[model samples]
Target chain A: MTARIATITSGKGGVGKTTATANLGVALASAGFRVVCIDGDIGLRNLDVVMGLENRIVYDLVDIIEGRCKLRQALIKDKRLSDLYLIPAAQTRDKTAVSPQDMIRVVKDLKPDFDWVLIDSPAGIERGFRNAVAPADLVLIVTNPEVSAVRDADRIIGLVEAEEKGPPKLIVNRVKPEMVKRGDMLSTGDILDVLAIELIGVVPEDEIVTVATNQGSPAALDPRSRAGKAFREIARRMNGEDVPFESLESKDGFFGRISRMVRPGGA
Target chain B: MNSGLAVKGVGESLLIHVPAGPWDEVLASLLQTVVDGGEFFHGAKLGLQLEDRELGAADLGRLRDQLAERGVNLWAVLATAQGTRSAAADLGLALDMGRPSQRAMQPDEPIETELPGDAAVLVRRTLRSGHHVHFAGHVVVLGDVNPGAEIIAGGDVIVWGRLRGVVHAGAGGDQDSVVCALDLAPTQLRIAGQIAVSPERRGAAQPEMARLRDGQLVAEKWIDEHRR
Candidate 1:
């Protein structure tokens, strides 16, 4: 089966792009879709660490692109999922080691065997970002609800439009519903009005995300994690499933009650 | 009208001329130019230079009527033939445009009026962060101007969509310049030498126009200036 390449990017750093990529890869592979996660961050490679597969890396994406090894030799099969694979980035070489053409060639080589190829793009709109998106059939821009992150997302959206990969979907990460109910933070509607794009997912700030990353396992594997549930919904949506968005107010707490009282129409 | 129309901007208005051709073809060609001009020739006084061509009164009247339908005024006719001049006179059209200076030298006229000159640029895309749109003329954007973006115009700036960026409307020190947008909550607004930050927005946004009021930038809801 031909694979659909999707690139996850955040113009600002620390906005959960790599985390989203790893979780999506895990979720898709768990759903019987053969998935491969590519670390496009190059020198600052973290997908392997986040995916809990850093110890088995004998070859990287550079080695495959440079023809030092066969395509299958560089692919590291996940310890849990037999069909899932990880292609770690080279730590010694910078982003210049792989060009956009090289990314296309590598993706073409893997398209016949996989169902989805998820590329985790590095922060900033540079060569690394270009290499990640050049082979993408769909682009997902990750951003925070803060003003600064939204501005950078807007710039990246403009650049993506310039590349003729228009109308990228947005994933708003680290949303604190308490601050939003207090009228102190920007809401989902506010961010959407500024960026003017489709919303794919809204991941609430959960401490389990930190726990999952620290343990070198994605949160999507946990059944009780809120962020993991959100990632699962995002993966289902990517698979063309009609999944209803869960309300952030589902957590019944003192803060949720105060928020519902403050804004009666809030979801 | 087809796009085979030659439109040239003269001193104050447009000069649309036609070469030697058939009566139907020339009229069609001339009318096409006026129609294809779109907003660029809207309400513009046109001088149709029909070099030595002879035309009937009904033909000239039909052309004038079509131009009037598009909001274009056929004010002057330039021709050497007697028949064309007579047709133009029958429709109350000017035989000669005279000198452009005569219109400028008219007494009791508003000489300081802002003429539609080379002082406006229409941007049809959103201005994202790190996008600097600096122009010596007035700036018009049809999309959003997101935060961290900056618009510097020597004249006024108008945004058809949201304006949340930093905008300096009168960079050339013209206090009369203004900034208008569908949403007027900009991060920073400057006119001439004064600078003002937008107040925290509450409730809903409305179309607002910001201009210098007593040497300070003041944003007021726009509710049809003619009605005001």
Candidate 2:
């Protein structure tokens, strides 16, 4: 099957682009799709660590691009999932080592074998970001529910538009539902109003995400994890599944307590 | 492809040798094309070489207004038409067959004018985050100025959309300059050398104008009476 290259980018740093890419890669692979996750953040690679495949990486993206290693050798198969693979970025080389056209050719070569090619874009509107988005059939802009993150997302979206890769879908991550209810944080609606883009997913704030990240096992592996489930739903949506957005606003302690108290049984 | 009607740069002004053609259509199309490319002709000094179309005051005045709407000034009209020359003189615009005098060209020179002032450039696109516009005159944007975007104007700024970006009106130390937008909330606003953070919007946003008042910046609902 032909692969759909999806690039996940955020202009601001530390907003969970790597985590999202790792989780989405795991989710899609578990669903019986051949997925390849590429860390587009040259000199600052982290997707290999996030996916727990850093030790297995004998060759990297730069090696393959430079003809030092075969494409097959550069790809490290996932320990947990056989179908999932990662072409880790070269930590020694900087963003200048790879160009936009190089990324296009690389992704095009991978298109024949994989079902989905997910690229984790480096933070910033520089050469690295352009390289990540150069071959994207779809672009997912991830942001937190803060004003700063949303503002940076807006800027990235504008640049994406200028590149004619417009109207990219948005995934609002690390949303604190209680804070939103208390009017202390921007709600999903408030963020969407300002950005004016299609919503693909909204992953609520969960402590499991932090624990999973530290363990190098993305939260998408755990069935009990809410954020993991949200990411799986995003993956499904990407695969052309019509999953309604989970009602994240009411699932916090406030509404959970009310629902449990009102309907004691299965209701 | 009309080789006779040469349009080229002469100093700062564009010298257009208007060849014999349908003057109305050619002039209108020329203006439309220039305006379509936003800010291409803003505040530009323009001269026309009208061979012998003895145009009246009404025709010249209409053309002048058209240029004015696009932020271009028709400074001179070189014409063999005596009526056209007279009309240019009536409008206080220059009229001659050859070059502009030193006095006429002085205002157009960057070295002569220490600062470009008052004349604003209007932009009709969203200034997304990280986009920047640095102009020696005023800046007027017809779209949203998202965060991370910046505008440094020598005079004033006006935006028709949300203004959440950094805007420095009167950037060259003209403290009397103001910034007005549909939403007057900016990440930071600077008039001359003073900087101010927009206070939280208590109520719904109305069309607001921000200016330095009483040594502190103030934003009030835009009213026509207070526009001056």
Candidate 3:
């Protein structure tokens, strides 16, 4: 199957780029698609740990690029999902160990085999960012609902446009809906107003996500996770399905009740 | 034979024109000139103009490192070749000398002649954050200018949509230059030497024009002649 390569990048660090990549890979693979997630952060490798495949990595992306290992030997298959795999970044080597051309060459070889290739990009618009974007057929920008994060997302959108990659979709992660209702946090509308891009999904802040991540299982695998459900919807949208956006405000506990009482109709 | 290299001062930096020659010879002569120039080359910003000379990222990176070792900063690279331009850009080098007219034209010196037709750039798309547009003449944008973007024009500036970015009109000291926008709320606005931050809006946005009045920048509602 011809795979569509999607790179997840956020200009700022600690905005759930790795978490989204890992979760999306699990969500898609659970749908019976062959998926491979590559960690593009070479020096600070974390996708393997997040994906719970760190101990299984015999070879990595740098080794495959440098001809030290075959592509099959480097791919560490997921323990839970048979068709899901990961090509972890080399913890010892830095970003300079792999070039943009090398990334393009590696992605080219994987295109015909997997149904989806999700690349987790490093923060900043440096060599690592360029390398991740160089091979992307689609780009997904993840951001938190804050001024600095939105500002950085705008910059990344401009750079992605400059690269001539089709308009990148947006995923607003770690959104505190209760805070948004209280006017303490920026709403999804406020973010979309500035970013002016297509919204794929809005994930509410969930403590289960932290538990799931640390347990080496993505939130998408947990049936009761709010964020997991949001990720599943994102995966469906990625597969060309028409899933309507779920309202984050309706689920907020006391704020939801008060808002509904004030408006008379569901927010 | 001539070494085929030329260097001249431009504002705060030196513009070096690299002549069409063998890559090795060109680089060797460039290093030799820097060495021969002594203290003049040290701590100086160099803008290398390579007209149609193709160079890869490795070559440009090496040259940048070599220049850095000599205490010379490689600020910009002006090239006509696509390969060379992309290489320079990938290396985080400025592609052109931005807003040269800002320094060249003196505010006190008045223009003595009127051109046949004044020049202006018409941008048809939104200018997002980190995007900068600098022109020597008027600039007319048909889309929104988001915060963190900037426009420095030597003449008047006009925006058909929201104007929320930093903008400078009459940058060359033409106090007569004005800025007009449908939604005239920029992060900061400047005309000639005067600067102002947009005040908080009390209601809906409306078309407005800003210009220097009695040595102070002021914004007035844009009223059509026929409607007035």
Candidate 4:
């Protein structure tokens, strides 16, 4: 099967790029597609821990690229999902250890074997970001519903377009519905207006995501998690399924009542 | 021998004029010249002037990588070929020197009747954050200018869509130059030596024009005479 490579990148740190990569890998694998998630963060490798495959890693991305190990030796299969696998980044090596050409070469080898290859890009539009994006067929830009994050996202989008890898899709993560209802947070509409990109998924703020991360398990494995459902919907959309976006607005909350009174028409 | 190649310093960067020739020979000679220059070429930012020499993205990317390995940074590409310009732009290289030392037209200089019009550059796409446009003449953008983007012009500046970025018109001290946009809310606006920040927008946005008035910068509603 020819794999479709998608890179998950966020220009700012701590905005859920690794989380999105892990969860999407699980969601896609569980849907019966063979998937491999590569952590492109090199020195700050965390996709392994997030995917609960830290203990099973024998070799890493750098090992494979440097010809120290075979590609099969570096792929750590996920314990929860039969078809999910991960190529963790080298903890001791920096981003300079791997070049953009190395990433493209490695991805070319993996394309013929897997159905999907998800790369977890590092923050900033530097070497690591370029390494991740060089091999991507699609780019998923992750950002929070804040001014700084959106600003960085816009910069990343510009860089992606400059590379001619556009138009990358956007995923607004950790959105607080209540804050949006109170007019305190930037809505999806506001972000789309500025960035002017297609919206892929809107993962609302969920406490279960934090809990799952702490346990070294992705929230997508939990069927009851709201973020998990959102990720599944995103996976379906990726596969060309026409799933309607789930409403994040709470219909019965206090802020919702105030908003309803203020607008009269359903928001 | 560095024949058919000229290197000169422009601001902080080195401007290299590459003569038109076979691609491989031109590239080899270019690299050889850099090698011969030794320490002077190392760690220098280069702006290549390729006159009518077409290049694709792969060729440009390879050249950049090769230069990078030799401790040189390729920051800009000045080319007459449309293909080379687009390729360089796709790689995020500056299309122009950005703030040329000489103005396109000096205010006190006598105008020539042979000249058809004032020199200007027209941009047809949205200018996202981190994108910068600097021209010695008038500037016109057919799309929105997002925040963090910047435009500096020697004369009037006009944006058909929203203008939310930093902009400076009349950079050569032409106070008569004006900046107008459909939505004239800029992060910061400057005309000649004066500067102004947009105030909190009230109500819906409307077309506005800003210019220097009595040595102060002010913005007013822009109304078309025919429509009015």
Which residue pairs in model 3 clash with each other?
Answer: none
Can you tell me which runs of candidate 4 are displaced by over 4 Å?
Answer: A250-267, B1-115, B224-228
Of candidate 3 chain A, the 10-residue stretch with the lowest lDDT total is A258-267
* Clashing residue pairs for model 1: none
lDDT of candidate 2 over A49-79, digit per residue (tens): 9998888989999998999988999999999
DockQ of 4: 0.54
lDDT of 1 by residue, B1-228 (tens): 354656666557677767776778777767677666678889998888888988888888888888898899887788899999888877778776643334334487565555556547899998988787999878999999999889999889999999999999989998999999999988999999999999999888889999988876789888766468
State the C-alpha lDDT per candidate: 0.86, 0.85, 0.88, 0.88
Label model 1 with its docking quality class: medium
Residue B174, model 1: lDDT of 89
Candidate 1, residues A1-267, lDDT tens digits: the string is 999999999799999999999999999998899999999999999999998999999999999999899999999999888889999999999999999999999999999999999999999999999999999988999999898899899888888888888678888898898888787887877787788777778888999989999887999999998999889988998888866566777565333443343334322
RMSD of 2: 11.4
Those runs of model 2 whose alpha carbons end farther than 4 Å from true positions after fitting are A251-267, B1-120, B172-177, B192-195, B212-216, B223-228
What digit string (tens of lDDT, one per residue) describes model 2 on residues B162-215? 998999999989889999999888999999988999898898877888888877
The segments of candidate 3 whose C-alpha lies over 4 angstroms from its true place after superposition are A251-267, B1-116, B223-227
Candidate 3 chain B least-lDDT 10 residues: B97-106
How does each model score on TM-score? 0.75, 0.71, 0.73, 0.74
Candidate topping TM-score: 1
Regarding TM-score, does 1 or 4 come out ahead?
Answer: 1
